[model samples]
Target: MSASSTRPSYAAVLRMPYATRTFTAALAARLSYGMVSLAVMLAVSRATDSYTAAGVVVALFGAASVFLSPLRAALVDRHGPRRALLPMASLYAGLLGALAAVSWRPGAPVPVLAVVAVAAGACTPPIGATMRAVWGELITDRRLLQRAYSLDGVAEELLFVSGPLLVGLMTGFAPPAAAVAVSALLVGLGTTAFVASPAVKGVAVHVARAGARTRLGRGLVQPVVVAAGVGLSLGAVDLLVLAFAEQRHHGENAVAWVLAALSAGSAVGGLLNGAVDWRMSARLRLPLLAVGLALALGVAGLAPGLVTLSAAVAVAGLFVAPALTTSYLLADESAPPGGRVRAGTWVNTAVNAGSSAGAAAVGLLVGRLPLAVCFAASGAVALVAALVSWHGEASPDVRTGEAAELVR
Candidate 1:
């Protein structure tokens, strides 16, 4: 296909056989992720009446997830999605149930709750990586694959936007435990459907060579690290935005609106990015977008009011999805043969770790420094990501119907 004619419309991508069903099921599974941490925090805090205990529990869960997600993805890469994801789903659901039960119990020890949270995080299914791998299997055309990844990015932004809203509504009308229970239900149903989807079942399984190493080596490591820095900036931005709203005495609703604006910009940018056929390689595009993100965020740090901050945030967010899409593409192109899912998982893990780090660091500084300083710190982190990605090895050009050979 010619370059101009190669970009597939969103509807065209969705209309592929089994595409809609697989995407919907994967979205359902992922939606729970947006709520699980917050739900756990609320439930634990309600039961213990201590934010410190709640924070510790949440931190343990995040730490477990950061360490375990890549291993789960490696399992999926080795055993195939159906064989790997279904069992993990069951374990995760059971653990979530255990967590809910513990939270509901009177006088449950904080240590016990923390242990359950860690186990629950460790068991969380590798749905995100598996779904991306499935897309790689389903779409062989490079342009179509790009569009699919872009669509996935947009869907992810939507999940973050709606997931928190769903939790808030559930907790508002019912007990905090209700939110946790609902999250478990959603994860159970969604993961089951995802594993059973025709797209997943139809994808070919890749078995690694016996005695092969599993960890990311040279080519794949840089992009994953860059992705982590991007994630750190993202997490810092989130905390800063919330702090900004609070400092201004804007209501909680205002915080939600500001976040929504950011999501909306990302979604729109992803759509536009996919609709065009860019000549630039993923290696170049990735850093360029990251630079844009850094600059926009830096400007956002200077905003004097809610409206100005929202505008700056929206502008910065416009680059978020595109940069992420490019990073995923770069990671995929650089991954070893039969290791795509593993590589994707590592990227996810790094991002999560960076976010956790950003949140922890900024939380400490928020009380002492100006909120705008937090934003500036986030921008600085993003600038670091941009520089790192720019200096990384050049990615092989993606060609229509051509399988990308693993780059050394």
Candidate 2:
């Protein structure tokens, strides 16, 4: 096949009914998850009257997700996505609702609220893992899979941009309790849509041969480690952005717009990934990403106004999702036969852990040092990740593909 012919088109994937269903489910999940986030922040802020407490609540959520993600992936690996969906969906919805109820109650205990947040966060299934598994089942062609993942990246950017704003709107106009309840409903609907799809229904669990191990080694696979480092670096960038907003005295509203700019950049990056031909090389993508991050931080540090910072951040963000896409592609390539599901899950877990650790570390640094210092620190981390990725050996599977192509 010609190189151009070998490239997959998003339009072709979209034409498939299975793709449509998966996209719908993913979109709904993003919306619900986004809504709950906003609602929870609002409710927690109201109840505790402390931004620090709100941060703790958010951190707790990340902690839970980090810990539970591996277990969730194991469940998917053993039982398939369909059977694993119900418990997670139910617990997430119920706990979020309970959180709202407690937030509404007069003089609610802070410890109780903290506990609720932890439970709700931990119960969140590895949605990204599940989605990737779905794509793996539905798209057999590597190029097509690339396009599908790129599309998914775009979808994620859209959610990041719109989710918080939508939540703000809902909470501003309606009661906080109402917003939380609505978020739960949306999550339930979205989760239901994903698990109930015909493609998802047909997903089969992999049964190991009697002699083979039934469980994954649970070790940090190489790709998973790299992806996690990327994720943590991104989280540091996020914290730096927040610090910038605060230092500039940009008020609460500026936060959303700044985040939106980053997200818009990510969406643009994803689109670029989909449009480009040939499987992208890590050496190329990683260096490009490092430059992008450096430019963003440099600009933000030099610029005085929100407008300049926003533009810088957006330009810098253009590399984020593509970097993620590259890592995911690498993970997919490295995955053992019939091990794609678990491998994907490990990636998700590593990412969550990275984000949590990065946020906490950067948040502390910002508290003790200058915002510019924090930005510099984050940029340095990104550069290090880029360097490591550039020098790392290619996965055996990718090497095989290249060798096969050379022979042909």
Candidate 3:
């Protein structure tokens, strides 16, 4: 049978022209992100002989990567991924290699490691945002885009899950530095393949000046706000879950399984969301999804046992993917022509920043408040964002305009 006749599933998304090759390359490069954190932490600890120094280095790396992501994405939108991403991937990979070399032996200066980590993080390729923008370029049918984004989200979830496992395997037979080096190789090779794609090469480069003059509409605001809320809750949930396990005196394995269940639920939810046809407009759907997630997390806190808690957390997971997918969909709808990458990066930046803030906030609160109260507060953060979004959707502009397209 012709590939064009592929059944209406996620398979159809991959079958789009140049979709398969481009997506495969992007995923290969992105796997490095998953492996990099663990490998870097291990390499730095052994090199500096201090976990505290290792953590500081890792935090610096993450701060540079997460906070500076939008600027790099803006560069890609202005220059096109080929001119922009190639140099970034090249330098990022090289830094990883240097990090590996220094971290291979003991007693590398902590300041030296910190500098390299920040440099590497700053240059890290904006593969995820670029891939999302590529999906925008490759597909215009709203449903197919939904499928593509859902598939992308699920695959990313799996990549992070498997990345650490791969690192563990490598470290068993070789030094942690080997995993770091492998991360470098993967991004270098994968990004090379990525830029060579006809679809990727075909991506439009906006005039930097025109892109600068154009402004994002209200359509972008709800998604970014809700995304931040989702991220904050999730970050708090991670630590809260750990506290839950500790309170019961449960082993580490118990925590692992519960977290795994959350990922599993998110994957399942993403697939299901892609397949369904929704009636609500994305502007409207955005708030409701957040409400569902917030409520589920609230329920999670009230559970009396691990099994019940896991079940509640799983329910929360179900909303996670759908909410984020809808946020991306909304961002795409709102972005100025050729600035899709930067717009999406804003949503990403909000989420990461929120996660960092949430973890820090909860880290302080968990020490003084009841665990159940902390979970409710975490959920409350999302609920407040949802309420604001609902109010925004009810505004005259949203109701009279833009509500015409119901993104699902």
Candidate 4:
């Protein structure tokens, strides 16, 4: 039977050694991150009596994290995830708890809340970076690494979708503060458990910084460019979702559905991208990205109802995670022996920045223009990004000496 025709069962996939333990660690870690995703927002907003102020706090947190990610990732590279995760996780939980407690108090100062947010953001646990570093350590084959990342992409989508949904429900039934507590506890417990996993503990981060002497720093350029393109596309799409929801006269719930649809699609796409064993050159792969994104964005314009819109969004999203996972894998291959985590961090940072810009611009345009216009414009932006990527030359492979691929 053809390998494509005779795919392994989920049970069979689960039986792979790295699949079981490493995936468990990833799940636990992601679940922890997901659990708190919205709880923190809810808590801050309640405590401050102003969602705007709370958003500022959250933004500050993200900003701090973006700045600190490289440093923390470097730590992960130098001293295994086990050594790096716990302390960072502890700081994250403690600050979150502090923010909750301070926000609850009647007389807590806004400035204090801002500081807490900064602290929280700064200590946001470079989970993606740490995980990517682990992936480089465990999964050796490039194809297998892609699959592993695809699985991770699924976990991430599920986390964002389910975490906020559950938190919203919890806050509605009980209280937002209670939800925050729950998230904090989960973050602490899950992070500790994942860090203690055998895979994470066994990792040996290169303490020395010798890798920077050669073309180590230069290694980041290609991946950063690719990541930026992907991020901008995603960001624009995210803004389009909000705009589309508002245009449809749908309630806030529409936003949730739209996001969930895109994320769900991306998750499925990651899996399919991972399973494919045949390698496609960058030249071929990059050009296809524009087509994938355009198709997805085009679907957004056809949003007759929530159901149809979601299906379209999902279809469009199918390209994001897999494309990103491939870029990340390529980044790993090009990274200096000791710079894998840092390389991953750079990718994350680039994507985050792109998303931020896309969301801002789309939000602005949607206010002044029609929903269809917004979607089309976003799609055009994504298509342009893909076109740019097509023009860039691929770099040489840097994995020749590595005995195994890094994964966790």
Per-residue C-alpha lDDT of model 2 across residues 84-115, encoded as one tens digit per residue: 67788789889989988888644566788889
Q: List pairs with backbone clashes in candidate 2.
A: none
Where does model 3 exceed 4 Å of error? 1-8, 205-213, 400-408
Worst 10 residues of 4 by lDDT: 1-10
Worst lDDT window (10 residues) for model 2? 207-216
Every model's TM-score:
0.91, 0.85, 0.94, 0.86
Error of 1 at 269 (Å): 1.5
Predicted model with the maximum lDDT: 3
Candidate 1 per-residue C-alpha lDDT over 182-209 given as tens digits, one digit per residue, 9 for 90 to 100: 8888889999999788778765344334
If candidate 3 were superposed on the true structure by all CA atoms, what would the RMSD be?
Answer: 3.3
TM-score of 3: 0.94
Q: Can you list the residue pairs that collide in candidate 1?
A: none
Quickly count the clashes in candidate 4: 14
Model 2, 297: alpha-carbon shift in Å? 2.9
Q: After superposition, how far is residue 135 of candidate 3 from its true place, in Å?
A: 0.7
Model 4 TM-score, all chains together? 0.86
